[model samples]
Target: MNLSRPLLAAAAALLTLSLAACGSSKATAPGGATAEVTVRIPDPGNSGVLALGKKDGSLDRALAAVHAKVAWTGSAGPFAPAAQELNAGQLDFALGSITSAVTALATKPSFKLFAATDPDPVGEGILVKDGSPITSIQDLVGKKVAVNQGGTGEYLLLQALAKNGIAADQVQRVYLRPDQSAPVFSSGQVDAWATWSSYAVAALADSGAHFLATGPALGSDNYSVWAVRTVFADQHPDITKALYQYLHDGDVRAKADPAAFLNVFTDAGPLAVNGRSKQISVDFGRQNGVLSPIDDTVAARFDKVAAFYAAQKITKSQVDVRPDLLDITKLPGGSR
Candidate 1:
């Protein structure tokens, strides 16, 4: 664990910069306590509450209750790289799926799940052309199916196969990121594309593609997850409480008027879809981003995801997600 002088100096400089970015504000808390009220959260420039909160200033306005402000950082998309950033103390908070979180855990990431949203299968599933012969899970046998490696796409695909008594190896798996898989799927290079969220919405909307097997139909336990740097959560419990409150309230508003909260619920990618696809994404957004504490039910779902990753040999070993979950109920905004 020894580092050269240059490396040590660089690390020290980075830490100093991070601290300066999150430097204490002059605001006083309820008990006349001077709170260090700056949270360094990611801005993936994509959809979701974080982006909406940032754009609308609701995230900052909400954090103001705790005398906190947000220091928006770089993108934390794709989860795995975000975990590395969290471990390196370069980021404070990020959003990810249960599948991403489980895989990130096996790498001994320095992040913890603090809040989560309910499972919404609206736009999660494998998409095939409208007239394709792949009508069911059974049709995937020996066919090339594109999926993001170690992500929701792969996890849902695997779960669907397992649920239908189909062997994982029976289907030809083509691992590709969303951007890369889009063209491949469009050109008929792949029989079906396993995806979730915006990508799924876009595919179905743009090409008249239909769900060959939906996430819920195939029994998906996917959940939207919020993760924070372990050190940040440990040091600023109040800040976490404020954040959870904001998310909860945001979800409430989003659900109440999904059309208005469309920007908050999803990014522009899916919103760009016209007609039924746009409506589908909006409907999915209604109850999708509801944030709640990582309670027993959430933990059980995450644990199941971990077990699946281990069984699929995606991880070296099974990771226990319970210990990494912060009991938000103990925080100030948790009860609501």
Candidate 2:
């Protein structure tokens, strides 16, 4: 994650040149300045609103106001690894849940929160086989529960345990990636699995695993969040602001017409959820997908979550994410 000054400069120059080469020189600014600029953003397998904007060219058009265009880059893995990409200067922007963001920040990664989704505790929880006798959160006391280390899965499990007045050490935490956890849980290697988003929906549909306890029922406040490379935000505040507004608009469109948003596609296929998991996906996004700019309220919520993670030893220590939040209104170009 460390880069010498010359190498960092070279990387930045290369990125600028690549963007300039792909941007449309014909685009103009109010002052007659050339608007040939492109901003690199991650296009992960399930891009959600990003796919809608990219497919409709709405994102590009939106960025045009800042004399910028979109440059979609393929990305992979969970938010923890994505944070590495941001720190390494491999991506300009990426999205993740607040749990993942806090975990990554605890390790001192170089990224900042720009926007966040309203926390929807639905679809996130611990799941067990439909007929399994482990019916309540208390039943998890001695059972093995699969969780993504220091990520959403772990956060959900710990939160549920705390809410039920159970200590985390009481349960056997089986840390695994989402893909890995799925098979293990299906094979009954783990007593339960704690997860969120499409993974949870797919698990219920494909494996018939019913929720032992859901986020809402457990009073969880896990949020869907977005992040930008710290250097990238500082260097291109205008593009950063434009990208945030574009995402907010796309979120609005998704909530307004879930079906249309689901229809958008990238090389991997449908942008949002479709097929058997469609309705649940729609419900989840509708109930929890509203985007809000990072403000005092949001910052305070994140601080609380960080403290919880630290208290439970899920994080090495509490991560103060307030310093990492980007206040777009305070930036020169961002004010517009």
Per-residue lDDT of 1-336 in model 1, one digit per residue for the tens? 899999999999999977754532344568988655678877736455566788787776777766678888886567767777888998888887888888888777788898888666577888899999988899899999999888888998898899989999999899998778888999999999999876777777777798887778977878888888887776666678778778788788777766664454444464344577658777877747578888897789888889889998888889988888888778544211
Q: What tens-digit string does per-residue lDDT give for candidate 2 at 133-238? A: 8988889889999999888899889999889899889999998988798889999999999998668877776688888888888766677788888876765677
Q: What does the lDDT come to for candidate 2?
A: 0.78
> What C-alpha root-mean-square deviation, in Å, does candidate 2 show against the real structure?
7.5
**Candidates' TM-scores?**
0.83, 0.84
Question: Which 10 residues in a row give candidate 2 its minimum summed lDDT?
Answer: 20-29
lDDT of each: 0.79, 0.78
Lowest summed lDDT across 10 adjacent residues in model 1 is found at: 20-29
